[model samples]
Target: MNNNLGLHETLELHELLLFKNTCLTKANTLSEVAQDQELKNILKADAKASQSEIQDIQKFLS
Candidate 1:
C-alpha cells in the first residue's frame, strides 16, 4: 500500500490537524467549567485523545 500523501491529501490533512487542534482547545476549556462530573471526564478524555492524534498528524506532516 502507498504511504505517501499527494498535494491534495496533504492539504486535507493540514485542515484536519487545524480542526483537531480547535477541538482539543474547546474540550480543555469546556472541561474547566463543566458542571457535571461525567461531562468533565468525557471532555478530558477527548482532549487527551485529541492531543495524541495531533502528535500523530504532526509526525505525518514532518
Candidate 2:
C-alpha cells in the first residue's frame, strides 16, 4: 500500500482507527451487560466487524 499520506490524512486515519477501537470496546462491554439474546448477538457481530475495520485502518496508517 503506497499510501503516501500527508499529515492531515494521517491524522484522519488515526482518528478513525481510534474510533473503531472505541466502538469495539463499547460493543464488547454492552454485549456483556445486555440481557436479551438477540441484542447480545448483534453486539457481538458489531464487535467482530469493528475489529476487522480497525485492522484495515491500521494497515493504511502503517
Name the candidate that leads on TM-score.
2
Cα distance off (Å), candidate 2, residue 14? 0.6
Model 2 lDDT vs. the true structure? 0.92
Give the count of colliding residue pairs in each prediction: 0, 0
- Per-residue CA lDDT of model 1 for 1-62, tens digit only, reads 11687888888989999999999999999999999999999999999999999998888888
Q: Please provide, for model 2 over 1-62, each residue's C-alpha lDDT reduced to its tens digit, 9 standing for 90 to 100.
A: 53688888898988998899999999999999999999999999999999999988888877
* Model 1 lDDT on a 0 to 1 scale: 0.94
If candidate 2 were superposed on the true structure by all CA atoms, what would the RMSD be? 1.2
**Model 2 worst lDDT run, 10 consecutive residues:** 1-10
Judged by lDDT, which candidate is best? 1
